[model samples]
Target chain A: MATAVAKKKKVRINGCVAAAQAAKYADVDVITAYPIRPYTATMMALAQMVANGELDAEYIVADSEHSQLSIAHGASSSGARVFTGSSGVGVQFAYELYSPISGTRMPVQMMIADRTLDPPGDFGSEHTDALSARDMGWLMGWSCDAQEAFDNHLLGFRIGEDRRVLLPQMVCQDGFFVSHITTDVELPDTGQVQEFLPPYTHPYPLDPRRPVSHGPQIMPEQGPPLQLERARAMEGAVPVIEQAHDEFARIFGRRYDPWLEEFMTDGADVVFFVQGAHAVTARYAIRHMRERGAKVGLVRLKTIRPYPTDRVKDALSKFKVVGVIETNLGLGSVSSGGVLYAEACAALYESPTRPLVVSFMAGMGGEAIVLKEFYWMTNKMLDAQKRGAIEKRTHWVGFEE
Target chain B: MPAIEIQRQMLPMFPSPNQGARFYNPELPETEPFVPGHRTCAGCGPSIQYRMTSKASGDNTILVGPTGCMYVANSSYLCTPYNVPWAHTQIGSSGSFTAGVAAAYEAMIRKGKWKGAFPNIICEAGDGSASDIGLASISGALYRNHDCLIICYDNEQYANTGIQASSRTPYGGMTTFSPPGPTIPEAKKLFPKDLARMMAAGHPHCYVATASVGYPIDLMNKVRKGLNHKGASYLMVYTPCQKGFVYETPRSIDLGRLVVECGLYPIWEWNPEKREFDYSFRPQNMRPVSEYLKLQGRFGHLHAEHIATLQKFANEQWRMMKVELPAALIRAADAKNLVDMASAEAAAAIAETV
Candidate 1:
């Protein structure tokens, strides 16, 4: 068994190029783009792909993010594999179209290279852009590196376009950390991608041969059923995502946990709960802590949309203390910290032996949680466990006293 | 990979079943894409325009409704009047969504994914959506030259939200937001944006035209013609609103004609090929602006001077259309020949009695 990069021809590329390469392999029919850092780099690679005759597709430089998403939704509705992306507030700019794209069951794939929101403009990773639209019925997840980013793009298309789970997907990566930084990515052969992802054929498309009305204004009574259907699609995507990963592994030779990736959690008492690219750094920190016999592990959340709630609860229940990482802003939210802390708290609340859950506002505004900070956070968790009562609900990392 | 050859032909335009000189109602498709049974007001001008536009497009069409009267009124309670594939988009998404649909079909057909002649992608945006919020988006679509028809159904006001004045609301037009008060007698101070012409000037490649429900044949023909054009096409159809315009429901079509005839609404097309204005379109007879305004209760508060101002505005429209102004129309523009509406005077007189 070869590593994913070793099995195929690996190329040193940034996250943006990896996304474009995946779109090329997927044979995306339409690529709508609105330039915003660092997602703009993905569009640049795609523009070159179209220009070089590498991909026979429509590359539309959209007027705005709202237009970009609308274009994606419309393209998907017309039964075409559409790819589009945005970053930071640009994602929020197109927020209005998110629900309609999914509600109509258009499996449009968006590459969100995370960036901080406005006022003090910063081109850095923050999950708030994609996380805010989590409940919009899109199969959402984050990639830890360029290789996983490429792999996730392919897998996202396969799972989203599945007949049982017709939904849009958000394939996210950290802005400068993942998008701009170059890494080794194994570009799969076109034949393998073809086998994994079938040509998308929506049940009800805008076709003259078969006329069907989609996204019609429904009755208030009908709202529940339509919502339930969307919920079912999100819920239904769990097995489909698992199947996509299994099939993806068989074809591309990269096996990944579809929900949570537990790193050295065996007989561990405390675990760090995180998502996106930070997990890569978290893995190194966990290994160092394990070497020191600190009994600390890492739990990387993969699919955040369908949430894998039961899986999360089961996995976190094994640990004595769970330190949730807050990378995105959620003002006035439960836990009054990042958005993920609330989700983690709720998932762990139903546990019989609830872990001492604490939120650490780390890696926000694109600052990486360094090795020393991880150790400091682990000590805080250890103190909470030793005292048998949590010191505080949340820690602002460097800011907190 | 082999290239697929899709048959590209215009849907043969047939003459009106009642082929009378006037009211020559073209034989509309029996398969109503915008069907009855939905809650559009009786004699809804925009609704009529919708039915006509969809009919012209036939079954092989995708209607994109922006947030406006058409979206709220037609597709209420999950019951869409659209039998053909339709989707509602944000008000400002009118052009972008339609562009997407058009772009999708282009890529799909070219890539040999979806086989068939390209579906007629159409956007039925309200005046507010088109003139204000969605202007830039529609401009973008037209500039990109997406093969779609974006019809800005101009009812002048935001009819769905209880008649607020939109950018398309004409000078002296009264609405809930533009009521005549002490400070401002001319309810809506600004002139209506020449949206269709702006579209034509900005995106010259697109086929742009102005039509009204007043001329059913012309409106349907323009719809078909716009759809026929390979590139983007914009048609701003003058849809009279009974609720917003404070006009009699039965006179919806009548107002349509009156508006055009009085030169308030000019009927013309922009020939993208020739890069010229097609001023060949003409109403039957030029009428006085007073005659057009008198039918609507919204204009009941207008004084003689306001009516004269409207006549001046109408004169400018006629001049823009290159139509010779009739002596009577010129005379009406003078304040000497005008008087305040009797209703306005009656209301003014009843102040103390009340």
Candidate 2:
């Protein structure tokens, strides 16, 4: 579909810059911005890009995060490719627009550079800000590194803008970890990106030529069907995500597992389960543990929404123990620790051989999960596997004895 | 790359309704963007304003309705009276959504994605949204100079939420939240916000004006003029609420005129080019505040002193407009000249019990 194949190049940039580059390569038409730390870097890069005439897009500095998302919704409703984002409490401030945007089925993309929510205003990475919006019918996932963050943004637009999957996407990365850490990212040629992601076109935009009313008040009886249709759209995206990842692999010469990226699980008895930037640390920890003749491996989850329940069950059934690293706070959750443990245990409940699952609160407060902490979590998982049962369901990685 | 040509639409301005002494309006646009058969009251003031505004903007328009009576009553049971494209936004997302639509057209037209003249983007916000919750968002849209019109159909209270007080609720007005009490005898103690002037003062680049549903031709012309303005514009039109104001349904338009005549609602425009107020628009006659207050039951509890307070407030508004006040209008601001409302005693007795 694309004719002008430019040369591909690699650049050393942070995750925020990678997101800006992805938006540029995708040829986004409208971008709404409101400054909040770490996500503000993305908007800064975009502002310069627009000024340099590298990207011809309508860049609006919205009054607030609420206005930012509202602008994105409006632009997307008018059949424009929109990109907007926030961090920390900025994400929570625009909480009201999440359901409305998704309910309208506008495939607007938001890049969330994850940051801690308030109570003293910490600017570290935390999943609670984005996890709070998981039930709002948006496609959500996390990227572990700058390169994956770049690839995920492109894949998010391609999949979310698909006709069958017209839901918004929150492509999340850690605040200072991936968002600030510079890494070598292989930027794609414009022709390759154009071929993968087509020009955005909604079936019914707010066009005067083709008049249509959107989001009118519906009767109580007519409510469920619309909600059911939204549900169907989200569920239908599972296959489209797989197909897009396949196409991405074929065209970009980069292959990635769509659901889980298992490393060193060939002959392992226990595994560390993680998402986002902490997985990069876990992989190094796994290599160190293997050299000491430990049977620990790593399983990094790529997508969390439309969560891969069957794949998680099948993969974890091979392990004796699965340690879920939660960089988020679930204050009064089921395991009395983090929220991921409950989801992981629920998915493995139907598995024939369920692994003894435990949650590890590591890499919290935007602190990196050092190799020492990862090794401590592996030892705790090994203790659970050897005893054939767990002591407590959760461990504060740095705080526990 | 060479500069791309962007095609813009310039709508023809309507002729003035006053043709010598005839007082007959000219032919209006035939495109009925807002049709009948929706569930508004018998003589809904906002519904009347919606009809006139859409009629002026015509077919090439996109209407954004934030959460209000216009959004709820006009689009009920999955049916809408709007024949043109309409989208419902959150109550606080009034300006931001309209800005998004305007920006989308700016980019889409320049990029050759959409092939047509830019559509008129209008946000119909209520007084509650315009003066209170969504104020900053509207200010942001205007400050950014988006090519759109933000109209605050001022009904004075939160009419859709069963009559509560908003920042635009006039002094001495009584809604469910602002009921007359022994301690608070005047019902609502605070004066209504000067919303339109505030818009003009804050964003001097925007064309800001005030109109009423009473003057249909003037209101329609202002709507067109706002649309014709090259940048963002604001209009705060007074639309009397029959349900909230507790008035007879047929007097909706008459109440609009009486409010302006009594000096309770000022009509003027903020000329951005001259950076001054244009007060040439005048009502047919000057009257006391009672002529407007006596018609609505919300002001039925006003005593003689309270009436003087309201008259003094109206007189101050007249002074700000630089209108020459009549002796009779000035004399009416004294407590000795006015009498208590008919039900003032009984209302006070009831108020003391509650």
Quote the true-contact fraction of every model: 0.73, 0.78
TM-score, chain A only, candidate 2, equals 0.98
Which lDDT tens digits does candidate 1 get at residues B1-354? 644555554976656521123443436567688888988888899998998788888888888988888888888887777778888888888999889889988888877788777888899999999999988789889999998999999999888888889999988888878877667766688888988889999988889999988887788878888988988999999999887776668888888888988999988999999999998877778899889888876776778888899999999988987788889989999988999865645533322121
lDDT of each: 0.85, 0.90
Q: In model 1, which runs have C-alpha deviations exceeding 4 angstroms?
A: A1-8, B11-20, B24-31, B342-354
Model 2, B63-144: lDDT tens digits are 9999999999999998999888999999999999999999999888888789888888999999998999899889999999
TM-score of 1: 0.95
* Tens digit of per-residue lDDT, candidate 1, span A41-123: 89999898788777878899889999899888888988889999999999999999888888889999999999888744588
Docking class of 1: medium
Q: How would you encode candidate 2's per-residue C-alpha lDDT over A109-158 as one tens digit per residue?
A: 99999998886468899988998898899999999889999999999999
Which candidate wins on lDDT? Answer: 2
Against the native complex, each candidate's DockQ, computed on alpha carbons, is 0.53, 0.63
Q: Where does candidate 2 clash, by residue pair?
A: none
Error of 2 at B329 (Å): 1.3
What's the residue-level lDDT of A3 in candidate 1? 10
What's chain A's TM-score in each predicted model? 0.97, 0.98
